[model samples]
Target: MATSGDETTAVRGTFGFNAPAEVVFGVLTDPDRATRWLPVGVTAEPAPGGRLLVRGGGHRAEYDVDIDPDRLEVRWRPATGTGPHGSARVGDAPAGGSEVSAEVRAPLDEDRLRRLLGETVTHLRRDVEDNFNAG
Candidate 1:
């Protein structure tokens, strides 16, 4: 889901998987796993003040990683623009499933924001199904 504003918009992408929150959170927080689903490449460190870049498609989302179990908030001042900062929430869903929802606030139109958010969540689904959930 996406909403519009004057120069900033908020977009969200939500997904569910039949896995534990810890497992899904690991995929989201781990740079390698995130790259597989969300970026062309990622370089990150696992602590506050540590930086990360999820770059691809001529754009990147740089973040000063502040890790937590249930929330992820990133604020990146993109030097050359074309990046975003977002917050994500991960938690347990019904029936032993896990749900992940990310909210992105950026200086972008609703259409473009929706596109990016959709792609990201879709990619996460694929990663979980193909790599982590494969039988």
Candidate 2:
């Protein structure tokens, strides 16, 4: 994670999953599946105007969701004022699975931001691989 300006922290990471890009993207956009992989206790729901309402850990925010199925990319930003925002792009891994490049920016400390990003990515990979095997 890197600090931008004085307070904002930015985190960028890449993770690989043993699943297709489609599968990863599916899990990301589906509210039920998304909540499963998000940070523990976090909840996500579809909101009006194609936005996503997320609440957890005593924090609540609404984000505008943008998706590009063809590119296997998904992005979200605060629906109103700026706070925390992120984007993930899924691509076919040369070895056969999928690779995801993710970025998150928030006005939080570097350690906290890094921990949150790491936790979410770990959960996302576990949920995606587990569900892929189940199905």
lDDT by residue (tens digit), candidate 2, 22-42: 888888778667787888888
What TM-score would every model get versus the actual structure? 0.72, 0.92
Candidate 1: stretches off by over 4 Å: 39-49, 57-61, 70-83
Clashes of 1: 0
lDDT of each: 0.66, 0.86
lDDT of 2 at 109: 84
Q: How many backbone clashes does candidate 2 have?
A: 0
lDDT of 1 by residue, 9-128 (tens): 888777787776666777776765666666334333333345665555555456665567545333334434544677777788998878887788888788877876777777777776
